[model samples]
Target: MLVIEHIPAAIADEILVGKERDTVVMTAEERRWGRRRLRSSAGRAVALALATGTTLAPGAIIAVEPTWYLQVEAAAEPVLAVRPRRCGWFRSGRCRARSSCASWRH
Candidate 1:
């Protein structure tokens, strides 16, 4: 599916009224953060590519089509959401970025 750049919030949720929709349950680790082509629970290789280095929260809309919406929902597994960081992490001297899950926290 064509990954959407603008979210439903950017437009409006009412646009989806009476429209077909599907939910893509993704493991926290699958997205963690950044743009990663993640596979949905339906086995469709849906791309969750985001440009702002933002992690998709559960219930967040990922993509939209002419007649449907691709949503992002967290899995039963622990949240492995990653944090956003600048490219100059090595130069800024703050390398401590939130990685995946509570177990990943340092």
Candidate 2:
């Protein structure tokens, strides 16, 4: 198992041009956790011990080995799409659609 304590800064595109890449798939909820164990596409175990409030974004590199790198990938999940008919009302906090507006207030 590989333990990663900190996430590296964004890697340059030129440095990753020829490297083999693998991804550690995570759900939206999983990405919010600062510490967890995940498995890469290649079945490698990765343990994260990140600092509080650290969130991993899609394509964020986790590890860079000699010839390969591991990154984070957000798994596709169903999401509710809500489009307000009046953008002005929604922005001003005076949306007339009480039912729809109340649902999101919590």
Candidate 3:
């Protein structure tokens, strides 16, 4: 098991030119976590004990070994799209509910 306590600053592409790459896929919600155990696509166990307020971003390199480095990848999540029945309501600058007009204030 690999315990990662600190995340390094972004590494330039040239710096990792010859290194093999492995990835750990995490969900959007999981990316916000500062501490958790995860598995790389190569099946390596990785534990993150990052500081508070530390959030993992896509492509973030979490570990660098002799021959390869582990990076983070965000998993695709389902999104809900809501469309109003009447598009004219917004085109005319008028909301269906007057009580909610404050929400549309710009």
Candidate 4:
């Protein structure tokens, strides 16, 4: 699964391109300074690199791919208990976005 850790850059062209599919509602972790971390409902990582300055609402698309759309879902509880263990060398093993996961292209 991918751990998206930032708001993706917005492209006007991409907005014009249009989604060939429906909007997807994915899980989002509220990150530092209002940035967002998105994960697909199926658990794949979704990348958001745009500057959305701290107010990306739930049900909003972080970014759109040709095949899939990634959105946000606010978790009422702390996100750690819900996600799988982290994928890195940290002793805490908390859920996090590794460099590999952050490398997902828009």
Q: For residues 7-79, what per-residue lDDT tens digits would candidate 1 score against the true structure? A: 5556477877776667877666665656656566656666555667566678877666778667777778755
Model 1 regions more than 4 Å off: 4-8, 78-106
Model 2 agreement with the true structure over 1-106: per-residue lDDT tens digits: 9898988787888888889998999988899998988889999898999999998888799888778889989899999998655544577667666665654532
lDDT of 4 by residue, 58-82 (tens): 6555556666656556656554555
The CA root-mean-square deviation of candidate 1, after full C-alpha superposition on the true structure, stands at 11.3
Off by over 4 Å in 4: 1-38, 47-52, 78-106
Best by TM-score: 2
Reference-based TM-score of each model: 0.55, 0.75, 0.74, 0.36
Q: How accurate is candidate 2 locally (lDDT)?
A: 0.83
The residue ranges of model 3 lying beyond 4 angstroms of the native Cα positions read 83-106
> On a 0 to 1 TM-score scale, where does candidate 3 land against the true structure?
0.74
Off by over 4 Å in 2: 85-106
Query: Per-residue error at 93 for model 1, in Å?
Result: 42
lDDT of 4: 0.51
Q: Rank the candidates by TM-score, best first.
A: 2, 3, 1, 4
